[model samples]
Structure formats: C-alpha cells, structure tokens
Target: MSTAQLQYQSQSVAKPYFIAAIGLFVGQVLFGLIMGLQYVWGDFLFPEIPFNVARMVHTNLLIVWLLFGFMGAAYYLVPEEAERELHSPKLALALFWIFLTAGVLTIIGYLAVPYATLAKITGNDILPTMGREFLEQPTITKIGIVIVALGFLYNIGLTVLSGRKTVINVVLLTGLVGLAVMFLFSFYNPENLVLDKYFWWWVVHLWVEGVWELILGAILAFVLIKTTGVDREVIDKWLYVIIAAALITGIIGTGHHYYWIGTPSYWQWLGGIFSALEPIPFFMMTIFAFNMVFKRRKQHPNKATVLWAMGTGVMAFLGAGVWGFMHTLAPVNYYTHGTQITAAHGHMAFYGAYAMIVLTIISYAMPKLRGIGTAMNDRAQIVEMWSFWLMTVAMVFITLFLTAAGVLQVWLQRYQPNPMPFMAAQDQVAIFYWFRELSGVVFTLGLLLYILSFFIKGKQPAAQPTAA
Candidate 1:
C-alpha cells in the first residue's frame, strides 16, 4: 500500500466512543441474562433485583448500547463518508465518558431503591413520582440520554453540514435528527393523564420503527455493496425501498398502542392498517440483501459480512414488523396487549433490524481500521456472518414459542370471566416465563461466541511489489 493510501489504523484518533460502546454492550448482555432468568424462576432473582427493575434494565440497556455503538460508528463513518476527519474528536471523547458515567450511575440508581430513596429525599413516598418503580428509571437515565444525543447530533450535524453529503450521509443525518427530537419527549412526565402512553410511544415507536430503521437499512446496504462487489445501483434501490416503507408504515403505527388507551376506536383501524404493511420493507430488505449478494459477480467468501446483512434483513421481517402486526388489530390486541407476544417482537426487531445493522457497520469498519484487505479477512468474516444468523435465528425461535404461549395465556385470562382462575391466570404464566428464561440463555451463548471471534486474529495481507 502507498504511504498516501493506508487507511488509518484506529476507529479514530480518540477511541472513547468505542470504549463506551464496549461498556454498553457488556451491560446489555449481562442484564439481559438476568432478565431471562427471572422468567424461568420468578422468585429466583428479585429484591437483589426486582422484576420491574430487571425489566427496565433490560429495556434501557438495549437503547443505550445501540446508542453507544452508533456513536462509535459515527466517529468512524462520518469521517470516511465525508472524506474528512471528524470535526472534533475531543468533543466526541468527552461525550463518550459523560454518557458512560451517566449510563452506569442511572442503572445504579434504578437498582438501589426507587421510592424509599426518593421518598427519604423528598420526605414522602406517597408523592406521584414515588409510585411506579419504572418511573424512577428515566428520572436520571433520561439526563444521560439527552447529553449523549446532543454530543452525537452536534458532531454529525457539523460533519454533514460542512461536507458534501451523499445519499448514505443524508439518511444517517435524518435518523440522528429524529433521535434528538425524540429524546426531548422522553422527559415528559405524564403524571395524571392516560395519554402518556401515546406520548411515550412517540419516542420509542418513531425512533426505532421510523427513523432509526432508515439509518439501519441504509448503513447495511452501504456496507454490503462495498464489500460484495455488487452494482451500486441495485443496493441503493434496496435502501430506498426499505426507508420509504418504514416511514409510511411506522409513524401511524403508534396507534397500535392507542387502542386500549383513552385515544379512540378509530386508531385501531389506523394502527392496524399501517402496521400490517410495516413489515413489508423489512421483508423486502431481507430478500433484497440476499438476492443482491447471491447474484454477485464474484463471491468474496467472507461469511460474516454476508451473513450480517442477510440476517439483519430477515430478522427485521420476522421480529420487528411481522410479529408486531400479528396481534396489532384492535380486536386481537385488546386481549394480547400486555402479554408476552409484545416481547417476542421487541427481541427480534431490535436485535435483527437495529442490532445487526450496527454490527454490520462494525464488521466493515474493523477490517478497514486494521489495514487489512477484504481478500484475507474473508474467512474470519464468514465465522461472524454465521454467528449473526445463528444468534438471531435462535432469538426468533424463542420469540415465536413465547408468542404462542402468550396467546394461550391471553385466552384463558381474557375469555374466562373468572379472571383469577389461573395462577395469574395459569400459575402466574409460569411456563412461558421459564421458556423465556431458557431462550435467553441460548441468546447469551450466541452473544458470547460472537464477542469471542474479535480476539481470534485474521490473516495478514501478503506483501505486494513496491510501485515502480
């Protein structure tokens, strides 16, 4: 390689974002494991950590880790995509540490005693804030999320504003903008109103389903086209298809949550119709990725990148948009709204669509950052690609099983007027809990192995003749 052309040998000059990402991923998996266990043995792991605490932990860590990973990817990607080094790596570094500290501190506060601690501080546990334990979670963590959002948006905003924007760059910018806008809504404290659910859904629903999904699909397609030697035109078309579909379907799909809330029966129709089609883009994205790669002019033989993109597309379909729409109808959701079926969609969509996309970007960047050529790391890539598939597929199976179980649970509880008949309607839904716990273990194994391969070194490039 020429002196002028050697890609820099790090995620960037300062790597705090990467460190933050590492911390978030660690937290995500560990808490996720604990959450899985709580299902199998209900009394097995509370007080040390209550189920609501675990539930909040599980949910927040997912959002936090993806933010961390995206931050790191931004540091790597903005510079490369813009063809300019990051405008302020120092600011980026500070943002990482700030978020890292805040994320940890917030989780600690969540675990420590939400009401009593706040009650002691305020001199009464009866205060509105002290009521639901989950409320305590966002109190501190919300600050952390806001700070992280500012740091990221400022960095990306300045970068894109200064540089020549490509289609990929613009797509990412739109996602970050949506992320920033959504973060503000997270601070809303809807103490007296039932409308808070709809409010909360704006941030959660719009960010993931609408904007972030766009970012995810765009980045994945970008990596695949560059790596797979496919025609750029074909890949860009896939990107457009997914983005348009996710947007058209996602914004209104917030109605799914509005059904039982004080909203209206009309939303049932709105949410059901759009959400049913939300999965279309994801389904197309999956078919689009594999079809592109399958028709590649020459196979690169790197299974990881190949699998990463493919798994992302497939899981998004099965998990996020598909499973969600299954019970999305007002009639059906009236029974299944709060049950385990909801969880099935959560695990798949986030893991498949968002999680896989972030990893795909990392897989692409790791090789570039290490100064290795694609021709060599292709083998290690295969290991990674398959790992993505196996883990996500395992999650899909787990989710499907639970969804079926949740269906049964809802049947016994909703249809039978004697509501207390079952143990929380059939032994407190014990069997489904156990199934979720076991499935979580399988997921943990997949993540552990996926993390392990980064340490196994890939082959170095063979020396080339010096340019004449």
Candidate 2:
C-alpha cells in the first residue's frame, strides 16, 4: 500500500466509521419514506405503525444518522486537527459498535413496543406511553444511550483535548460537546409532562437550532472552502455570520413553544421575535454556497456534490427556517401547533439544510477516503445532484401545499366559531389534504432516487472506505 493508504489502514479513521455512517444513512432513507408515505395516504401503510410510532422513527432516524455521520467526521477530523495519530483505533471501533447497537435497538423498541405498549408490557397504567414514547425507553435502553454517548464523548473529547485546536476544530468540538450535553436531556423521566417538554426542547430544539447547527454550518463551510479552494478567510467569515445569526435567534426562539403550554407570557414574545430571525442564517447559507462557487479558485470536477451541498444549505434555511418563522409567532402559532404546516417546515428544513450538509460532507470525504488522485465519476455526481434538486423542490411543493391546508384548518378552527359547525370547515379543507397527498408522492420519488445513489457505483476507484 502507498504511504497514505498504509497510514489510513493503521489509523482509527481507516475503518469502521464509514460502515456505521452508511448504516445510519440506510436507516434514515427508510424512515423518510415511511414518514412521507404516511403523510400522503394517512392510513395506507402505517395503520399498523401508528402516527407517533412513525414519528419516533422519522425523528430518531435523523438523530442517529447525523450522530453517526458526525462520529465518522470526528474520527476523520480529530486526528487531522490534532496533527497526530489517534489515541486509540480499538476504542473508536468499540464506540462504533456501542453507539450503533444502542441506536438500532432504540428504533426497534420504538417499532415493537411504542409507549402504548408500556401498560401491557410492564403492567403499569398511570404512565401514558403511547403519546410520548420516551416513557417506554426501558431503564436499559436509556442507560444504553447514555453509555453510547459517554463512550463517543470520551473518545472524541480525548482526541480534541490532546490535539491542536483550530477555529474549525473548536467549532466541531463545541458541537460534539453540545451533543453530549443534549443527550443528557433524554435521560430524565418522561412522567413529568411539563418538565419532559422542557427537557425535550433542550435535547431536540437546542441541539438543532443552537449548538449542532453552528457545528453543521461551520463544518459545511470548511468543506466548501477546502474543496473549492476558496480563501479560508472568506469561508470562515461566512461561518461566523451564519452561526452568530442562528444561535442568537435560535436560543431565544425556544419561546415559540411556550405559547400553548402553561408558561409565562414572556415566552410568546421571546420565541416569536427571535424565531423570526431563524431564517437569516439559512438565507446566509444560500448566499455563502453560491458566492463560494461563483468565486472558486479552481473548478472542482465533482460538480454534483457541490451543487447538492449548496442546495441543501439554501433550502434548509428557506424551507425550515424562513417558512417556519412565518407562522411561529405566538399570535399565529396558537392555532397551528401540531398541524401539517409545522410538519412541512420540519421536513424541508431538516432534509434541505441539516441532512444535506451531512451528505455533502460524505460526498467530500468519499473520494478522499478512497485515495483517488482526482475527482470521482462525474456522471454519478450529476445524477445525485439532480436527485437533490428534485427531492428538495418536490418537498417544498409538498410543504407549500400542506401549509395552505394547515392555514385553512387553523382559520376554520379559530375564527369560524366553534358551534358554527365542524362539517362546514371540514368540507372546505378536504381538498387541501388531497393536494398535500399528491405532492408527497412526488417527494417520495425523489427520496427513492437519493437512496439508490448509495448502491450505484461511482466512477471513482471501488475500494472500501476508511471509517474515520
């Protein structure tokens, strides 16, 4: 083997991490399909699965995939950042198995025993399991997740503390730290409903909106600049811009959730005002990608991945961040909470912004890990890029349709007067749901093609990927 290949083979980054990431990817695509279909046909495939059950699948899959992908990236990055070999390849491998096992088992439990099963499984009735499945995490599963997080944190944290810390490394480390802290939220007992929501927001919302997003935006900008040969100074500048905007706005944005719950009146004011700026970072991301591409020092042969990354950054901000802002106001969101519009915002934002960024990282590293001298097969990149656009645009359409439906539903429920009649409102909004279902079908096709890309061989050398 060549020097680089030999070094790669002996290193922690050399194996296992990629396999874990790919597994998460497969699980994620399946979850997306399940969630998408459920939205369209409502009762078609998921009658057996239940809505909340499908929800846990969808949301948890995203968390797992992103977590695994981040682990893979950290494995790759930590050593590079430290300017030395990893502390322990064996430990890295151990973490892969531990985390992978924990993630997979958690999802399986979700499928087989959703919270509703708690009463039957454990002979307990006072605890409501079906609505909030976290209640069902069995002490074992909760402990397992904690163990996995600790193992990962120990491995990554050691590498960072012992190694050099660049601006990029600092940002990445911050994200991992945030991830570790956030997992702590999942540890609490769900029986405390109000407290559970508070903790849930801490784990789910804070990680995505605040810390990890900064990590995502930071890492994504790093890849774009590195690959495109843009000035690091410019790229880093953009990173500062996006993270600053996302955090300041996102942290306070938590207030939006306070509207319905038994909370102080200030949350309404806080959440609405800050969340309105949530899209600013997303908007900045779109500009960052396009601007970098336009001014690239040299054209990268892998046009498709570049396009997809940029597309994801832009769309995530617009679909998830911007549109989410529109109705998030306490005044507006009061009626639309738990509705399809929220679903629409979540789908586009996550897939477009967060999911795409991780995929972009995968695309960037694939050729590097394989040790191919130049670009991989351009054809696949182009095809994958097309799939990216198709899926995003299609999803946007679906969200738009759903948003229309949700607005109609909200207006009918809130304004038309309760006794004015359920039948009248139901009759008016029936067609919107039909439109959402139709849009969902198109979105599903796009996702299928995305999943297919993984199996299709690219033009690059066909060797196993290094996990780091």
Candidate 3:
C-alpha cells in the first residue's frame, strides 16, 4: 500500500466516532427542547417523559457525545502529530463500537425503565453509583466506560509514546488520563451528602473546569496550527500558558462548588478568588485563536472550520469567562446558585468551551476523513456557517432569557423582603421559560441544518493528497 493509503487507513478510525457524536448531539438537543417546554407547560410530557427523565437524558447525552467527540479528535490528530500511523487501528475501532453500544444501551435503559427499576436491574444496588447528576449512568454502564477508556488510552498512549512527541498530543493525553481518573470518584458515593458532593465535583467541575480545558486548549491549538499555518512553536507556547492557567485556577476553583456544600469557611474565600481567576485561561484562548488566525501564512479552504475556531474562542470567553465570573463570587452565587442563572452559565459554558470545540474539530477533520478535500463545497460551507450563527444566536438568546428568569426567580424566591413560595416563583418566571423554549426551537433548526450540511452535495473539490 502507498503512504497515502496507509494514512487514510489510520485516520479512517475517526469517521464513525464523529458520525456518532453528531447523531447523539441531535438527540441531546431534542431532549433539551422537551425539557425547556416542560419548564413552562409543567406537564408537557408528564409521566411519558417527565421533566427529570428528560433532564437526565439531555445532560447524559451531552456528556456521552462530547466524549465521543474527544475520542474521535484524539484518533484523528494523534497519529499525524506523532508522525506515524496509529499503534493499533483495530483496537480503536473495537473500542468505538463498545463505547457506542454501552452509551446507547444506557440511554435506552434510562428511557425504558423507572430510575429505581433501572438501578435494580443494572445492579446499582450492589455498587450504588447511580442517581448523581451527570453521573447517573448505571454501575454496569460506568464499569463499561472505565474499560472502554482504558482500552482507548492504551491505544492512543502507545501510539504517542512510539512516535514523535508534540505538546498537543502530550497535553491531550494528560487531560484524557485525568478525565478517566476523576471519573472513578463516581463510585465513591458516601452516605454523607457533603462528602458525596465534594467528590462529585472531582468528576464534574474538574472535568469541565480543570483537565477538560487542557483537552480544549490542545484541540484548539491543533486546529489553529493546521488552519492558520502557524508555527507549532508559537502555538505550543500559547498551549502551555493556557494549560497552566487552566489547571492552577480550575483545580482550586473546585472550591466554588464547595462554598455552600458543608465545606469549611475558608473555601468561601479560596474558591471565590481562584474561580474568579479561572477566566484568564479562557480569555487567553480567545487571544490565542485570533492571533494565530490573523498571522496565518495561507488561507485554508475550510472557512467553516476557521469560523468555528474563532467562534469557539470568543464564545468560550463570553460564556465560560465572562458569564462564569458573573457567578463565581460566593456572595453573588449565594443568590444565583441553582437558579436559571446557573442554567444560563452551564448552557453557554458547555456550548462555548466543549461543544463548539468538538464541532470545530469535526468541521476541520470530517471533510478530509470523507475524502472531500480540506472542506465542504462552497454551498455546504455557507449552510454550515448559517447553522453556526443560528445555533450561536439561539444559545445567546436562551442564556439571556434564562438569566432574566433567574434574576426574577432570585428576587421572588430569595431577594424579596418576603419571599414567595418556590412554585409561585416558578410561575412568575413562566414567560422567560416560554422565550427560552422558543430559542430552543431555533437551536434545533440550526442543528438540523448542520446535519443537513453533511449530506448536501455540490461541485466537488479535488481531494488533498494525503501523506504517510
């Protein structure tokens, strides 16, 4: 086989993963719309698909799909960065099927059975790892995840160790390892709520705010380097700075979640100060992306990828940095915690930082994976860009509407001289929920267009020659 064919065979492992991620993404957004409507209608899907069930599915789908994206990204980029084919393409493909099967079965179990029944059937009674938000996967499913992750890391790790080492693959591997390690805490549920919650942040806050940012930075840096023709040295420098800042702040920033969760008082100040600094890395990422793009040596034909790259920077800053800082301080968070404001931050931060980064990688890699040149045709690019703006604008509106609802919820439920009842407060915020649901509709449309762009045909560009 020629060098080009060998490279294609190596990278081809990523195509199914990307496809699965996008497919799951659509499911997540659909469930999100269902949950949004439930906020106002109160019984929109009721027993058939209760608000809690919809929420669990929505959140779980988000995590699962993003994991797929991350894995797909690693598979797509690691070999190239290492200057070799994968250590074991067969292992990567096998793990993909295993992970996907486990994920799909878990989701089916959630929707098909009652929570308690699912727990019983899945042997959660023996392990007791279910019931936590985002960690709601059954004990069996969690075990499957761990096994899949181990196999995955072994495959990627061997490839990276055997080939040339770059800062990108190294940092990415570090993050993936941390992700798997932190997830072990899900099985550490204690009878003490305080302890349970504390360790839970190890899995949740640490993943998103901590190591996952490492993954985000590495992926963004790789995309920027490819799209902008920037020197790896320059991008590597930014990656180091961003990763250091993200870890320094994000690890300690876990304190922010500790403030009211029966932790020590010192956490109030420690969490507040450190979490406040968390935005620095995201802000740095924004500058890093634009600077690299502005300094590009050549214009890559993948305009949609570049757009997603730039958008990831700006939006991650706005969502994760600015909006997150909006609530990181203990005093402000005291009022905003658990309110729609929290939802606003969660929605945008996840979208801006993780979801967009994943999509950015897919945008950059999918064309090449499909042998369709470095990008989609002009018409598809236009459609994809339209999807980008539509989804982004819709998300902004969703966040804003949720923020409005949150503020009102705070005032009526917490800030007022005489607080209203919880359900009463929810009733008062119904209008904002209506608006949020509408924004969700727009988001769904954007997602559909995004999916459509994949299939839309146009004049084909010459496939770029691949290398070994």
Candidate 4:
C-alpha cells in the first residue's frame, strides 16, 4: 500500500453524514419518480401529492443530499489533507443531527400540509421568501439553513487553519464559504419580480456554476491523489486552472438568466457569449481525469471510485457542456426557454456533475468506514458497476425523450404557422412523456440495486481490474 493510503481515522466523523446522505438520496429518487409519473398520469397522486409539492420535495432533497455529501467529503478529506484531527468532532456530529432534524421537519412541512398552510405555520408571513421556484422554503427554514451553514463553516475553517494547509483544503473551504455567502441572497426578496430574479440567480446559478464547481474540483483532486498515486503537484496545479476557468466563466454566465427576466436587451449577447464559454472547464475536466488515470503510479483497489471519477468527467461534459451549449445561444433559448429541454439539461448536469462526484467520494470512503480495506469485494463492485451503467443509460434516455418532447411541443405550439394551445400541444408529446416515465422507472431500479450492493457480502479480495 502507498503511504498516502494510510489516511488518518479522524475522517470517521464523516460516516454519519454519508449515511444520512444516502438515506436522503433514496427519498430524492422516490419523489423524482413521483414527479415523473405526475407528468404522464397527472392524477397519479392528485390531491394527496400534487405535482408542485412533489416537485418541491424532489428538488429540495437533491439540494440537501448534495450538501450532506459535500459536508461528508469535507469532513473526510480536510483532516487528512491538513494532517490533523478535526477541530471538534462533537460539533460536527451535533451539527449533523441538527441539520438532519431541520431537513426532516421541513420536508414534512412540505408534504403534510398545504403550501400556504406551511407558509403560515413556518412564519413565512414574517418575511416573504416562499413561492419562488427554488427559494420556496419558508423564511424560518431559510434562517435554520443559514445557521447550520455557519456552524459548518466554523467547524471546517478551524480544522483547516490548525494544521498544514494544502491546496485541496484551501479550495474546499473557499467554496464552502462562498456557498454560505451566496445563500444569504435568498433572504433578499424584493417586491419587484425582476430584481428578485436577478439576485436569485446570484444564489442559484452562482452556487452550481461557481462555488459548487470549486468544491467538486477539490474533492476530485483529493480522490485522484489518493487513488491514482499521481503527484500532488500535478493534481494541485490542474485544480487551480479548472477552478479559475469555472469562476471566470460562471459568474458572468448569470446574464443568461437575466435575459428573459427583463433585465436588459444587451444581456442576450452577453449571456450567449459567456454562457457559451461556461462549458470549457467541464471539457477540460474530462481531459484531466483520463490523463491522470493513464499516468497512475499505482492501480488503486477502489475500481468503482475510479469509474465514478472518470464518468463524472465524461457525463459532465455531455450533459452540462454539450447539452447546455445546445440551447444557450440567444436564438435557440428564445424558443426552448422553460421547455423540457431545460429540464433535460438540468437532470443530466446535476446527476453528472454533482451526483456522480458525491457517489465517487462515497464509493471510495465507505469501504474504509465499514472496516474493509479500500473497496468492497469484487462481486459487490461488479453489482455497483452494473448499477452505474443502468442509471447512467437510463438518465440519457430520459434526457433524449424529454428533449424530443420539448422540440415537438415547440413546433406544435410555438413555431407552427397556426399554433395549437398549450394543453393541445401537450397531447402530441404524450408518447415522449410515457417514454420518459419508463426511463425513470429504470433509474429507480438501478438506485435500488445500488442500495443493495452494500449488503451483499463476499470474500475480501484485492482490487482487480475490470478492463484491460
């Protein structure tokens, strides 16, 4: 084993966070399935679970689980990178329970009562932060979130500062701090819808496209360093270049959202050009991952993690980069705005860039958490690999079907000489909707199998290569 593989046990503080993350991930997929079914059946859950409510659960869970994953990643890696114990393990655990409790109560509020009722009970009337797309959480819940984020930052910040500072820890801390800062924008709700949306993108677009990429890059670099036995110098250098590109392109790319929100006419060109450049970093990431793998000094035992890391690069490029470019042009977006095409890009981008990276870190770390060596047995790994392909392929089909549905709807309802009404146009795309729903089912099955992989026990074998 390499010296780097002797990672300190202080990372154990991350275990509960990862467990909670996987549990919430299951909830996210289930709610997503509900939303997919609602698209086709419309009355699948009806009054008990309306499309809007289900959609809220689906999106919010994604956000929460990803946050959980990031927290876990930070807890797991920061201590090792800094060469010390966490500043306060008890504080990390306390924050975990607090965050999990708050998240559960908030989701229950979404599900158990009417949204209006939730707003009133949660004291949204004190401040109006509800009813917006992603900012639909009540003001009180938003406050809880802010408090949790601050506690998290304090815990991580002290740990990073107390020991040897590495490029990975510094980048992760910066990303996490930016996340908390930007989220403050969510508390700012203006009466003017235009201004509301402008700042809203500061939190929404900037988080995913900006600081979140920094978190993603840092985590990936840490994993690559541990897994590939690559020189930290090389990985550290690449991390700087990628994050620099991400911020340079992503901050200005917020203009794309401003274009339709009545910001200004000139934003169209600005949005088009800068948003077009947003994909460059993702493409660079793909090249970076494979290059590191081929130059590996030692083959890691955790093959699943390697697959996930490589997949992140490829899928992120296809979903976030290529698909995003498809409609980022001012002309194309003018037609496809708010269509299923946007949803298609979203599903792929989130899963590819964020979800896959979380799984990558979890896959690498969980075996150690379980007292196993560096990975699960070969049989479990094979099952995990199968689940990976199933989920990835299913997502691809879902995106294609939705993209087709969006195109058909645009033609029938917008581009036709005599356009059909919205509802009427929907009927024409029903087939695609059904296809998308079926693809979602496949994704769920894969998720279930992924869960089952943890329980399937086998002989402890050294890591073996699945490819030449």
Candidate 2 C-alpha lDDT tens digits along 1-468: 233532344244533566566566666656655665555456756557876777677677776777777777777766765666777778778777887777777677777765656435643443332334333454565566678777767776777788776667777778788877876766564665777776677766887788887778766876786657888778878888888888888988887877777778888888888888888888888888888887877666666668777877777877777778878888778777876678778777777767777777766666556655334565566657767777777777877877887677677766556623545665676776677656666666666676566556655634223211
Q: List candidate 3 segments past 4 Å from native.
A: 1-8, 461-468
On residues 263-371, what C-alpha lDDT tens digit does candidate 4 reach at each position?
8889898888999999999998999899999988887877889999999998888998999999998888898898888999999999999999999999999888777
Instruction: Give the Cα-based TM-score of candidate 1 against the true structure.
Output: 0.88
C-alpha lDDT of all candidate models, in order: 0.70, 0.69, 0.92, 0.90
- lDDT of candidate 3 over 1-468, digit per residue (tens): 222422546978988999999999999999999998888888897798988889999999999999999999999999989988898889999999999999999999889989889999888878898999999999999999999999999999998999889999999999999999999998999999999999999999999999899999999999999988889999999999999999999899999998899999899899999999999999999999999988888788788999999999999999999999998899999998998999999999999999999999999998888877777998999999999999999999999999999999999999999999999999998999999999999999999999999988998655343311
RMSD of 4: 2.4
Model 2 TM-score on a 0 to 1 scale: 0.86
Model 4's number of clashes is: 0
Q: Which 10-residue window in model 3 sums to the lowest lDDT?
A: 1-10
Q: Give, for candidate 2, the lowest lDDT window spanning 10 residues.
A: 1-10
* Candidate number achieving the greatest lDDT relative to the actual structure: 3
Superposition error at 359 for model 3 (Å):
0.5
